[model samples]
Target: MPATGFDNTIEVVAVVVVVVVVVVVVVVVVVVVAVGVDVHVVVALVVVIVAAVVVVIVVVVVVVVVVVVVPLVVVVEALVVSNGLWYYPHL
Candidate 1:
């Protein structure tokens, strides 16, 4: 039995095809990395915005509690004391 040999044209075509496939894969990977970086930046910006909103809300709540509720309580206590409602019965 005689051995069959591989064609030279086929060998060259195979090499070219392999190189093209590798180049396409590298391009795709680079594009994916760029998109991922963009996504990360957007997410970071959103997180910062959300944190700022939360801080503002907390400050407003603290201000209202300290400035409004405390004064109201003090006024109510004063009125009660002035009306003889908190008198002691010690002789």
Candidate 2:
């Protein structure tokens, strides 16, 4: 894959994360203001949402590392080896 494609994928992932966080925040605020939910309930809801967001972020990071960074690294390593750029000295 091209570098531009990787850049686009990263941008898309970032946008998705931002959108998810913003939507969660909006929903929580709307529920508090319009529904007048109990304070404890709101707090619990926020906790759950936060945990979910954290999980999402972790998953995305792992995916990007595995899918994008790892492949890129392997490609670069292969290129270096093929070009005889890597150096070794007898010890």
Candidate 3:
């Protein structure tokens, strides 16, 4: 069986939630470490964590757009074109 849009959305939401939870845990850990660590070390660690988080977010967005959004648009376009409900200018 093929996966539906709802399944895809659920998967995406799960991934985002997991990422958020991880970020929160890491932030908490960093805060705890900052009290005992040097300021420069804490800053560097934070920079690295932020960069990693940004990269993860970018990857998730790209995957959602390409894997989910683009295919959904194509499927809807095909359906519309087949039913003669709308003109598909590209084709």
Candidate 4:
């Protein structure tokens, strides 16, 4: 016996439907994993932790500039120059 044209078309359609379903499942799984936590959580824990780290670094830099570096610079400038003129007569 030989296959007819209609049978060939039905087989192609079935294959296409299966491929589409598989692709959809894969996409959904990838999205879920990328989120790193459940969808119900309003804020992802991973994102919150990263933001916290950034805030800590910014605070440390601000504290260092105010407490240690700014005073050092002011003292050095006062000792080295006065009235916008170099204190030493010769370079």
Which stretches of model 3 miss by more than 4 angstroms?
1-37
- Give lDDT tens digits, candidate 2, residues 1-91: 5674455666777777787778777777777777687886678677869876796878688777867798899899878877889964531
Q: Quote model 2's TM-score.
A: 0.56
Query: Which numbered prediction scores highest in lDDT against the true structure?
Result: 2
> Candidate 1: global Cα-lDDT?
0.60
Per residue, candidate 4 scores C-alpha lDDT tens digits across 1-91 of 5543333444554565566556555655665577655663324444544555565566556556665687698778777786655665563
- Residue-level lDDT of model 3, residues 16-37, one tens digit each, is 7687768767775776676666
* Per-residue lDDT over 1-91 for candidate 1, one digit per residue giving the tens place of the 0 to 100 score: 4332322434544565566556555655665567665776566556655655565566556556655687688788778888988874561
Worst 10 residues of 4 by lDDT: 1-10
Q: Rank by lDDT, descending?
A: 2, 3, 1, 4
lDDT of 1 at 63: 58
Q: Between prediction 1 and prediction 2, which has the larger TM-score?
A: 2
TM-score per prediction, in order, is 0.52, 0.56, 0.56, 0.45
The global Cα lDDT (0 to 1) of model 2 is: 0.75
Q: Can you list the residue pairs that collide in candidate 4? A: none
Query: Who is ahead in lDDT, 2 or 4?
Result: 2
Query: Model 4 scores what on Cα lDDT?
Result: 0.57
